[model samples]
Target: MQLDRLVARTMSRFAKGGLASLRPRQAPAEATAPLAATGPDRPRGSGSWANEWVGTKAAVERAKSLARPGRKRKSGKAAADSIPEGTIRTKPLMSARGVKLHNWISDRLEAEAPTCTLHACVSLGAFLSADTAHEGHDPLAGLVADLLIVDETGQPIAALIRENVADPSRHLLMLDALLDADLPIIDLPAKPTLSMLWGEIAETLPGA
Candidate 1:
């Protein structure tokens, strides 16, 4: 009985503060961990610029919301993406050569046994809330995904980015924000073969 009681008391002390003592050492990592990324971790080259575009953009939106709380933004992104209301599309909504790559991805989704969903030109602003909130949250305002793969419940599971890498100013920012938002990002080149696209998509999915 004495040994059991002592063990319980020692455990109580450890539970009370032992965890907290370790937190200070982990503070910096924790500060950055809020930028949690999920899905395919692509090899962004060494030259990828580390900018605070997400926080800056978020701050701007927050300020706008505060100044005009009564004002509301419209849903014109759908029109920009050329997506029709009330329909599930097989291929991504695009008007360029990227159609081939987008089509390949849609085909892949259709073949999945459990059957994930495919969405084209998904507006990050529509589903993400970081725009009206604080810094560090990915404010994906005015950003769109080339394609989004969602689970059966309409929750985004993966994203495909078809970007012009020449413009890192926007592309890199989008990449970082998507990572911070905890969404998987797949980089599909404009002109990839069936095997090339498969490799890119497969790398991000589980087990590769």
Candidate 2:
């Protein structure tokens, strides 16, 4: 990776500065009142010292600044569409069913980049969406994915995938016998299975 000249210079300056404090400290003022726990000798408003007021005021200012409106945010759909380059999206090459295919893709992505988010489409009631943000499940679970797979029974692909990935979860065997009726599902090699599953992943990855 190449560094820009200005950025490199700034980093060098930081390195030379080490980890010491950079700002000048001001002197503390005398206390306005006695300790609050004390009787009438103490100051009013439950205050121990005037410095407390200064700290409180500074905190209030910071809170106000944070609460103020930032630059109007871009629309959610537009922001999602601006995904960075080199992002991999593909249908699963080896799975018993399409939902399994979706999970297979997610698992591979997690293996490649554990921190990268994975999402799955879900449906509730009569509507379908990638709104797993409100699912109240594991915090580390991937975000709601855009791609959705459904069987003739209308079961959400996300639910099935989540079940397969999470521990102590319900088992979901593929039951959609009709989907492969029109097309021939590719069969994995018998006995020698190592080459069958991983080969698909290798071919999909870059520089494979």
Candidate 3:
């Protein structure tokens, strides 16, 4: 029993000493010393520490960049090329050809068509007729004719207008509407006359 006790004591001491010896020791002060005050390219320590520091800094910068907000997304309804509101002029918006046609019609009504009178002041831009002009009506709506001809009695004589060659679809639609309405349509040429217009209207009339 005494021999077993001595062996146990020796074993206990050996076990404690063995475990202490197996544990890793703290690094020397010199081994873990700070690098010299030098540029990154000239690091004093083994390159592993400098490389780890550089990698950490790079990761932090990358995280910052990722967290930054990006540009806001544009709305679906927003158009890059759309004209600003109120910027579009309601009147005097007609093309040069439209203006010339308006003047010609005005002159003819004043000189030859004494029974007919100018319906409204001619403007270059599209305008809604009293029949169509109402609340919720789009002022910038497409037009069927450049001018509406009316008699002194305020009867709609015809739609005296010109075709817009630039927009074939719009021109066709306008022409179709006039035909469906059974209204007289006088297509103005590059240069139109009062007599030619009157002749067309007379043909459409019942007892001309």
Backbone N/Cα/C clashes per model: 0, 2, 1
Q: Which candidate tops TM-score?
A: 1
Model 3 C-alpha RMSD to native = 33.8
True-vs-predicted CA distance for residue 198, candidate 2, Å: 33
Question: What TM-score does candidate 3 reach?
Answer: 0.40
Error of 3 at 94 (Å): 4.0
Show where candidate 2 strays beyond 4 Å. Answer: 1-81, 97-122, 125-208
Q: Model 2: how far is 29 from its true place, Å?
A: 80
lDDT of 1 by residue, 36-61 (tens): 34557632322111122233334545
lDDT, residue 207, model 2: 36
Instruction: Rate residue 174 of model 3 by lDDT.
Output: 69
Question: In model 2, what lDDT does residue 5 have?
Answer: 32
Q: Mind giving the per-residue lDDT tens digits that candidate 3 earns over 1-208?
A: 3333334554575567743333343444443443356666663534444344344345545544543446244554432325543465655556687666567666766766767654433331232243444676533356556667767666666777676889988778667666656777777776766678667855644345
Error of 1 at 12 (Å): 78
Quote each prediction's TM-score. Answer: 0.47, 0.17, 0.40
Stretches off by above 4 angstroms in model 1 are 1-93, 131-138, 165-167, 203-208
True-structure Cα RMSD, model 2: 22.2
- Global Cα lDDT for candidate 3: 0.56
Which run of 10 residues does model 2 get worst, by summed lDDT? 171-180
Candidates' lDDT values, in order?
A: 0.59, 0.37, 0.56
